[model samples]
Target: MKQPTLPFWQVWNVSFGFLGVQLGFALQNANVSRVLSDLGADLHSLSLFWLAAPVMGLLVQPIVGAASDRTWNRLGRRKPFILGGAIAAALGMFLMPNASIFVAFLAPMIFGGMMLALMDGAFNVTMQPFRALVSDMVPNEQRTLGYSIQALLINIGAVIGSILPFVFTNVIGLDNTAPKGEVAQTVTWAFYVGGTALLGTVLWTCFRTKEYSPDDYNRYKNIAPKIVEKLSLTTKLANFWKLFINMPKTMRQLALVQFFSWFSLFIMWVYTGPAITQYIWGVEAKWFDAEFLHSVDVIPADIAAAKGAAGDWVGITFAAYSLFAAIFSVFIARIANRFGRKITYSLSLLAGGIGYISFMLFQNAEVVHVNLLLTEIDIPQGALNLLLPMVGVGIAWAAILAMPYAILSGSLPADKTGVYMGIFNFTIAAPQIVSGLVAGQILKYAFDNQAIYIIALAGVSMILGAIAVYFVQDNSDSTPDERAIQGH
Candidate 1:
């Protein structure tokens, strides 16, 4: 039995919640390093602090995946988990930037780190079910389109989330710089807005999407309906171990690809703020040191202002890449169908590799003025050139969000889709965990504490990921006639 092709609107609704989820993530990625730095985290410890995100994913995703597989309630199988996770994530978003409020209990950086972990844990709980839902609902032929639509919504949310801080600071004239121990109002407001948006969008998806009943799911996926039995803890653990040991061949092959891809992404997220501020704005790393902050009543006015401006600009650069990814997602399904997923994914990662490598090439700090409609804004000359590289990163990001899942979904057993999808996240989480563990040391010893070289290193890793993609076997490849009919 084949799953019925959902209407385009239903397909669109299936992934609409991802928009809010990605919004929360984009804010985290674009600003967390800057937030931690402002809260007194040092340059050498940024990656360690960043470990909170992937670490949470490693711990949360599989458990949520397996639990959701057996969950069937009035709220629907995936929707309950999705709604619950979103509420928790929204709370985390509201609290993370305001960690300074809890300084009496713990240091601001420590509090912020704890909030980051909570937010990411909730994100993982929400994300894995969404991945499995697409596979469960969409027929084999529409898988690429389903995932591409998801990628599109994700990037759109990212674009908006990435730019909110900049919009608050630059357009609304919010106070971008605050005291040494406090976060800027611009960032604080962005989080408030993002948290609200996250709840609203996720609620839309939960209310609109109707999951298949157990019998219907079994019939559609061609699986025999077995008695629902509550397994003991030992049996559950044993089953999880068995699944891990015998993961699909495609999943195993894609692990290396995922490793390189996420390692590069982790580096970019952890270092981009410091890289842009120090490399372009010439802000010293020592300025953010905890001891230094403790000794001085207030940071020097110039350094504080420059750091604030640079942080805002970092948001713009991240938003640029997300915007590019959003644009690329529209045609990604057609591209994958035309050239094959392997070729499409490989070339995209190669482009992102080149983009990351090019970051070091533009170092000019001269200011440039650009008029937008009725207003003019000043931007760094070097920073303006940075958007060029983001184009490549954007293409790779869109493919990264869509292609692997499209390939892996075909190879999964019908009833086990949720567990396998959760298991696949290990590939994404492990590389990031490794990168977080060693990246700061690499920067300190090999790169002489220069964050820009770390960006270049990310480029190399992406190229390696591009090479590894060729080794994966794409079980979901379409025939020539199918491609022709799909307008590829």
Candidate 2:
């Protein structure tokens, strides 16, 4: 039996949770480094601290996915995982920045790291199921549209989350700085708002959307299992390895591109805070580093001011990119229809690469003079440089979130969709892990401790990803049954 196609609003209802989830994620993404730095983490160890997120994602997603597959309760198949993850994530968001206040026994950085891991793991739990849910409900023909809706919502949330700190500091007159080791009032309030949004949106989806029963889902997929054998933990672990060994050619090809894409993104996320602090603000942020703070003679007041400025600009940059992503998402479907998905995605990535590269052009303390409509406006070259690149990042981000999964959805077995989506997360997680491990060392030795160079590396990596996409065989045009057997 053909799965009934959902109307746009129904699709909207099901995917709307991503908005809040991504809001929580975006807030974390944009501000975690700032929070950690404020709590006294070193630039060299920043990536190591961020390792918590990807490591948790690597372990959590597949387990959550497999569990959701076999689960059947009054709450529905995927909704339980979704709701559970959201609740944990909400708690995590609230605790992450405020770890110093809440978990005062542990060092602020250590406590924040634990909360980061918790939040990231919970996000993976929520994220994997939602991706699989889209595949489960939307027919192959509408998969792109469904995922695009998700992309659109994700960007929308990101925009709000990324801008919150800036808004709080600038608009609402919240304090963006705190005493030596506490988080800023701006960050604390942002996390509180983000946590609330995350839970509320997820609850809306849980109440508004319904899922096919497990047996009914199997029937719809045209898979008839003679036995309902329960899977043991041992069996599940073995199956994950088996699935990895037997991954489809398309997935293998996409994996290469995903590696480069996420590696660059990981670098950006890890280094951007320090880069802005050091390069744009013209202040060393080493007061957060215990060793450096003890060894060097620097005033605490200067260090706090620099960190605050960097955090505010980073928030603004993220907001700019998210805004661009949301705006670009409006027309992405139309563009993809006119041009092939591969071409569109590749071009979008290439644009982002150029945008990232532009950052290198600005000199420290240089003013960017803009002449718009006979008005002369002077913007900091460092901050203005980020805005244009965000357009490209935004475009590429929209495609990255939607295109790969939309192609893979048809090729996956219907009953195993959750597992495969969980498995696919390995690609995203592995790159981040690899980058996290090596990024600090690379910056220390190769880049001469210059954080800005990491963005350059990210730009090149994105360009490489754009080239890699053409090699993948897009299976978006094929039906599930037709493509499922073909890939295997």
lDDT of each: 0.90, 0.82
Indicate the residue-level lDDT of 393 in model 2: 81
For residue 37, what is the lDDT in candidate 2?
Answer: 74
Q: Root-mean-square deviation of each candidate, in angstroms?
A: 2.1, 3.6
**Candidate 2, position 364, lDDT:** 51
| All candidates: TM-score | 0.97, 0.93
Model 2: per-residue lDDT, tens digit, 1-488? Answer: 77787898999988999999999999999889888876778777889989998999889988888888888899998999999999999999988877887554888889999999999999998988999888877776788788889999999999889888877877778888766667999999999999999999999999999898767777777888657677897996788899878977778888988988899888877777777777776775445456775464444675676678678778778877888888887788667666666777788888877777777775457766755332344546766666777888888788788778866777777777788788888899999999999988888889877888888888999999999988988765555543454351
Off by over 4 Å in 1: 372-375, 477-488
Worst ten in a row by lDDT for model 2 = 370-379
Model 1, 1-488: lDDT tens per residue? Answer: 66788999999999999999999999999999889988888887899999999999998999999889889999999888999999999999999888998989999989999999999999999999999888878888788889999999999999899889888887888998978888999999999998899999999999889899998998998899788888899998999999999999999999999999999999999999889888988887677567777889878898988888888888888888999998999998888777778889999999999999999987888999976443467878898899999999999999999999988887889788888898999999999999999999998889877899999999999999999998987765466664464344
Residue-level lDDT for 386 in candidate 1: 92
Prediction 1 global C-alpha lDDT: 0.90
Report model 2's TM-score to 2 decimal places: 0.93
